[model samples]
Target: MNIHLRLLLLAGAAIFFGYTLYYIRKKQLDLYHSIRWFVLSALILAMALFPELLTVLAHVAGIEIPSNLVFLIMIVYLMLTCLSLSASVSRQHARIRTLVQEAALMEKRICELERRIKASEENDDDIVAREAYKDKSR
Candidate 1:
């Protein structure tokens, strides 16, 4: 790579690394999510510092163009990230569904209890009124 490109990559990697750390410290990004960003930044820094490594990787992977290797790596990484995020979203959706079902069941139970309480109160009032009537008759 040219000197200008290398310098740009280095600066970009440094900025990305710093941004990742800042978000982690601020509690916006957790450790699990920050790991991928850290790795990505480190890889960029490595490639910028030693462009020869890319050539060697490309040769080993049987890719004629080193740039193509970079593209392939990025594509794979993005695919894995998307898969992980999708799985997480699915789990959250299931948990939310369970929570809604449980809430509905709880509401039903509460309504039933309230109805029973009202019926018991009415029965007690009738007994009290009947006793009062017998006492007056005596």
Candidate 2:
């Protein structure tokens, strides 16, 4: 890689690393999710510092172009990230459905209790009125 490009990659990797740490510290990014980002930035820093490493990796992987290897790695990383996110979304969806069902059940129980309370109050009023009527008749 050219000197300018390497320097750019180095700066980008450093910035990414810093941002990841910042987010983690702020609690915006959890350790589990930030791990991949840390690995990515580290890889970029490594490739920038030692351009020959990419060539060696590409050769070992039977890739003619080092850039192509980088592209492949990025693609695989994105695919895995998407898969993980999809799984997380699926779990959240299931949890939300369960929560909605439980909330509905609780609401139904509350309404039933309210109805019973109203009925009990009305029955007490009738008994009081009947006793007052008998006392007045006496």
Best by TM-score: 2
Alpha carbon deviation, residue 113, candidate 2 (Å): 1.1
**Per-residue lDDT tens digits of candidate 1, residues 60-82?**
99999776776787789779989
Off by over 4 Å in 2: none
The lDDT, on a scale of 0 to 1, for candidate 2 is 0.90
Q: CA lDDT, every prediction?
A: 0.90, 0.90
TM-score, one value per model: 0.80, 0.84
